[model samples]
Target: MLYGAAYYHEYQPYERLEQDIDLMKEMNLTVVRLGESTWYSWEPEDGVFKLDWMDRVIDAMHAADIKVIFGTPTYAIPPWMAKKHPEVMAQHHSGTYVPYGYRQNMNHAHPAFRYYAERVIRKLISHYASHPAIIGYQIDNETSSGQLHNPDVFQKFLWYLKDKYKTVDNLNEVWGLTYWSHRINEWDELWKPDGNSTPGYDLDWRRFQSQLVTDLLDWEAQIVREYARPDQFITQCFVGAYSRPEANVFDISKSLDIVAINPYHVTQSGLELDPQNDTDTIGPEWMTSRQDHVGVSQIFLNGDWARGAKEQNFLITELNANSIGGSSTNYPGYEGQLRQAVYTFISKGANMVAYWHWHTLHYGFETYWGGVLGHSLEKGRIGREFEQIGAELIAHSDILTDLSTQADVGFLYHEDSKYALSYMPALSQPGTGNPDPLTYERVFDNFYRMYFNVNAQTAIVHPEQEFEKYPLLVVPALYAADDALLERLVAYAKNGGHLLLTFRSGYGDEFARARWAVAPGILRDAVGASYQEYSNLMKEVLVKGEGLDLPEGAAATAWADGLELESAEALATYQHPHFGQFPAIVTKVVGKGRVTYCGTLPNMPLGEALAAWTMNKAGIDPVIEGLPTTVRVTSTTATSGERLLFFTNWSWTPQTLPAIPGGGKDLLANVSISESDTLELGAWDVKIIVQAK
Candidate 1:
């Protein structure tokens, strides 16, 4: 388990490399990510390359026994490149070129921009590839920004569409361009996406934009691999669904070695484990935003998303350090809170945990984005907490590395659906007539938190992944899917896998076009139900009965589907004036398996009951039983044949639970405990127990 921060030796106001090294050693830091954010420091002038300065920092860190991870510095182009190649500046959807003074303002697909970025990536990797201190390379930081619409980029998109469709008529036919008199006579007659109202055209354009970003990172990976040694892996730090909905993490990560993510959440009351902590970001627009919640399921969702990137153990390239956000927002972790954050990441298969920075910045837009050491450049509470946690990580080293997390429930994360639903949202804000652009994530999170709050260890499964390993698969808002994918979902259910479907699923084709078949497109027969009409609610409407644990006060929120059962039975029904005539949930047995469709988004109580029903249908027990809501228990298996159970208390109040049913060694305390014993945990505590599988 490696621990440290993104050490920007060049960003310091003065010469304090020696002092930083002392502090890192004090915390038993094992890794340092260097040179990712500073493109100007790499090449100040157009043709000038000043690269030897990094050698001093890497050597010193190596002397202090810390591993190094180099970055390609392609995301932030130098100033000279911007001045020399202004054509590379990216244009937004409004037909306006983004001004300078901001990073990622250029088109990644532009030829001239690629030339300079390739040069720097080659220079950095080749110069430091031979050093034993280096263990990996990050091709880019965060990777994608808002979509690029440069003229050249659009021309490239035109070429892509032409190659895909072969003719303008084919393109028009596929995109349904006849609507609104949008039918094009010539390819050049097509309009920009700014004023376009066609869903199919907008969907294809968004997909092409994502392909450009994928090609950009894959190009960087190709260049870096030319110099990177076999021992050094390559990765891109992805800030998933939280930001940059345009960047397709699954396709981009295919060209790299492992998946890395930057999962940042709120501190203080945000981590309280309260059910009503309902604050959250507004989906892809959240670049610098943070979600406040009592249940820390978002981080787990982020981790599971990363794990699904390559379907393996992943790394935390960046995470929370202290009080994050602007100057006005200051809520750093309280006492043991920082330790809980670290362990939370580890519990979900983070091989390495690195903070955003080693020290706070003295001058920058993120000056208030605090770090391990604050602006005082002094040892503070964050440092004291990490010192102890860092030592504990070293003590539990062997089992922690390369541990694989397993879950019987697989939740599908479809980026195409997330993108398609964004343009054609199904839900709206509570009292507004406007659509909620984050409808997909809103629906996804509702189901994700439902299962998490019920203590079900759920795994994120992508569209291309094998689904047979999971006995139950919950698909939320599979709003966009092709015939092949929908057929596969039916086959999985027929083969004895419990399948749970949600609203907006199977409603559209791969092109985001509403299917001509009866609602739910191809999966209607398997689902045993279909809905032709749906409605959004301004407020909650009561829903009752059916689910085994359905409690009182359960209601349907947001959108509801008027589902009519064919060969299935009603599980739950809405208590609305008209919606009561239709079922809220329906289920049917197909072959050896069963299919359950949720026609409406359930509130917390109903969601938990539905989650429990899904578990019961799958015939699996909760990983942990009779534990406080504040305590999270999860299990991961090591490649060396051992089951490692992680117990985490998310609050300041201590907790006690029955020890897991086995005599196992507590990896954190280096003590042994037998079955039928009670386990004690302090405020904001974490424990890992290892036993024979």
Candidate 2:
């Protein structure tokens, strides 16, 4: 496991290379990332290049035994390139080109942009290809921030559709273009996606945009592979779904060697809000706090998603080393918060954890975004804490390396479903435009959190994945799906895999058209239940049941389906005035397996109960039973075949655990512990145990 920070030598106000290297040695930082945010300095002119300064920095770091990951620096275009080729700037939906000065604002498909991008990338690779310190390359910094909505991009989309559908009639039929008088007789008749009312066209447009972004990344990775050594890897730093929704991460990740993510947790103040409360009416304090909860969960969720993307261990290219600036609320770190954060990533099978930056920039756009070292370039609270984390990581590097997580529960996540549902606003809340946007992400997290509460290990499974490895599979709000995927789910369940499906699963086909058959379309047989109508709840509905562990009168909100069971038994019924006694939850048996359908969005308590019950029925066991809600436990297998258990206290209060079943040594504390020994963890603390072989 490598420990370090992204270094920006150009951002320094003075020469501190020697001092920084000494401090890095003290902190046990074995690696440093450079050249990502230095495009303007790298190529000040169109054809002129400066490599001496960066070469010196790499040489110095190599002398100190510090490996380097060189960035291609194509994310930020230089002023000369943009000024000379104005067509490279991304044209927005409003028909205006994005202005210069911001990163990721250029049209990735623009020939001029690609030409200049290739030049800089090739130049950098040629200069640093044989450098001993250069161990890897970060292709681009956070690809697909801006979507191109210009004529050129639209033409490319038309070409993509033409290639896929082969004929204009096929394209028109698949997109249901005749609904809005949008039937395209000629390819030129298709305009930019500004006011298209056809859901199929809108969904396809979004998908095409994702493809363009993937192509851009693939192009860059191909160029880098030409010069990168066999030992050197290539990756791109990916942001979460909160930003850059146009980029299909799974597609883009296929071109890289390993997945890299920029995982930033929400502030401390943000963690205080009610997790279930919507942020629309909440005050800044509550809103930020709620986002913190989402952010923390996303770190774990995205890590799993990234791991599943390539089915390999990933890296944290950028993690919060200090508080962020701007409109975001900044909160100081509590005791053990840093330790808990670092260990959490490792527990999820991350090979390395690197902070976003080394020192806070003295003057820049992110001037207030704190770092390991503050603007004063001195050790601060976070820096000191990181030093301790660095020491521990260096001490346990061999034991932690190659460790992989083992999860018995899998949640199905489909990016196309998210995109298709995004265009169908009628499925969301009424009266509010863009109502509860990010609902898909929230629903996913809510279900995952329920499993987390009981300390069940889970993985994110894509719809295309063969998830037979997991005994229990939870498919939540898969509003759009293809027949092949539905058939696969049915076969999985028929083969003795337990399946839990929530509202909106299998409602539409891949083309975003309502299924011609009964509701839940092809999945009706697998689920043994059908629904013709579902309401977006403006008020809470009560649920009563004995099937799961849900308490009577438990609240169900946000959405509810009027369900009718065909071969399934009603597990729970709605207590609403008009919807009374209607099946809100149902279960049926298929072959040797079981399928449960949740017809409404269950509250946290009910969700937890349902998850716990389903997991038990699937014969899945938690890492440690009877643990507090404030504590989280995850287990991974070490290279030596030893079982490693990670225990973390997320709360500010200290937590204690009863004697676990395994005798092991607490690697963090360097102390042996017996099976019957009681374990105690301080606030925000973390403990790792390697079970006796």
Candidate 3:
């Protein structure tokens, strides 16, 4: 339940450290992160450390009763390091160096960069380890900026392959490199990744790159742990890892304590939900998919991803204080939107909430990136919003901090599928013929949105985690999976679990090679259906059949699997000229469980109808009946054995809810609520009820 923002005393244009601290103290700010983005300020010259400069700021934080989370400022490099060793600069996949003008452009895989990074990290942590106000250390700004393609990095990748496969023959066999005479007799004959077209090479190369990034962070955590007390934690802030191609957040979380993310999204209209407003302001860089992207759902989806990273409560390391992105995208939350976003994060599993910074930078790359205080350095709407929000959090700290979010339906987040799909996408952008590299995210988001619409509490589970406990498992874009993983999924179906799968699933093996057998290679029997051919749609196709209560416009888009029934029943089929011969959706009962397959990506209404049908068959009902589309509800089991339910209104119009099934205490009002009494949520509002066990 900690609340505050990142403080950059060094970046402040004037000497207002005392004033800023006073304002924060007055606003009930609980904690502030310090010193993560300033390497040049920490060490202006090579071997010359200005370590004492941060001491006064830490003292001020302690005096004001606000805690601190210190960060190792290694994400950015000083000018001297780049000048001293130009090789430390990261070389991109295009054989060009990432220029020194930007942050996180250094090739941490390079030994020279590691040497200086380690030195600065150790120096920064040891200098302030004994400070009473410091609670933890953020290892790096983002675990990785992007993958490095340096010559040395490439050589290490070759060694990584050798260590993994043990022989060149094994590498050629697994990757199916014999195609087009691309098979190599020796590891030395392998071509550079820039000129390579093999899917196996691309998949394995991405894995090697992820390993390098993980190793660097693990190295940083080990160094920080040397000085960190048992009470203090070590974490790294990831800015929507899905957006960062090189970052493997679930794998990276294994090295640290908590998973933290920057859940930035469009506010105002972007948060609005309606069929007409679906794709209005969805920036290409926003958190969710452009199709039916509701801002609150996008944020909660990210929180679920973070919670699943380690299957524990996560931290909101950074979120919007004002308009999040660059200048043109300036649109902060309206009225109660900011507070609604906070509760949404908590409804998932956030233990802490912190903004990017305490005050807006007057001059810098983030100058327009507003903060609690704007350019005037005075508290405004942003400050007032957090003021009430912070007070509410402090009052409910006991129950809020000790709860674990509940999950109704689970989704598999496979890194291999994400990476492989990025390299070879299955769908193309509408109206534009360009290949959509974010094909994995598009399909994944669409499915997630579907479950969210049905009020099925979402849980993002990794492949290594146990998810068979959930009643329904929806897997989207499972395009590249090995036989072992696919076999486990089939077994899940046989064990009385309801499994939902979508197009392009099981088409490629782990190495991204198309299965020599028919489509859905290892899963055809368990799935009770098989598809030999698939096509990307140039136009939408109407689907009509059982379980699909469609409107006039309910149609399938993007890609379609020409599913031929074996032992499965057709749940839905395409209404097209020749493609109608194959089913678009199929289902079959296996052993005691059932398998449902979706052969095409459906539009919003169609997708929702499909989800409603699957959940009906799976016997997974909505948490609450008669809930509004603009209102979202989630619950967490408090340590005290009480169930805490959060109700959020995502629109500008206030909404009334149906009477509670059982009476509960409204913690916000400090009053008891009766089962017969209904509650009203204001525009962009939130309400939490504590129901006794």
**Best lDDT among the predictions, by candidate number:** 3
Once fitted onto the true fold, the runs of candidate 1 whose alpha carbons sit more than 4 angstroms away are 275-295
- Top candidate on TM-score is 3
Candidate 1 lDDT, 1-693, residue by residue in tens: 999899998889999999999989988889989898988888998868898788899999889999998988888887788788888888886578788888888888888988888888877788899999999999888877477777887788889999999999998888898887889989899888778798888888888988988988888899888898999999999884444767888898899898899887766666667445423432222332323222377777887888888888788888777877778777788788788778777878889999988899999889988888899988888988888888988987787888888688899889889888899998885578798777888888889898888888878888888977799999999988998998989999999999999998999988888899889878889888888888998889898776444689988988888888899888899998898988888888988999999988898899988889888889979876788877888889887889988888877677897757876888878888898778888877888888888
Candidate 2 off by > 4 Å: 241-243, 269-296, 426-434
lDDT of 3 by residue, 382-470 (tens): 89999999999988888899478888689998899988998998888776688888889889988998788778788999999998988
User: Candidate order by lDDT, highest to lowest?
Assistant: 3, 1, 2
Worst 10-residue lDDT window for candidate 1 reads: 281-290
Residue 431 shift from truth in candidate 1, angstroms: 3.0
| Residue pairs that clash (backbone atoms under 3 angstroms), model 3 | none
**Poorest lDDT segment (10 consecutive residues) of candidate 3:** 283-292
User: What's the CA RMSD for each of the models?
Assistant: 2.1, 2.6, 1.7
Residue 58 C-alpha lDDT in model 3: 94
Clashes of 1: 0
Residue pairs in collision within model 1: none
Better of 2 and 3 by TM-score: 3
Candidate 2 global lDDT: 0.80
What's the residue-level lDDT of 693 in candidate 1? Answer: 80
Error of 2 at 626 (Å): 0.7
Task: Assess every candidate by TM-score.
Answer: 0.97, 0.96, 0.97
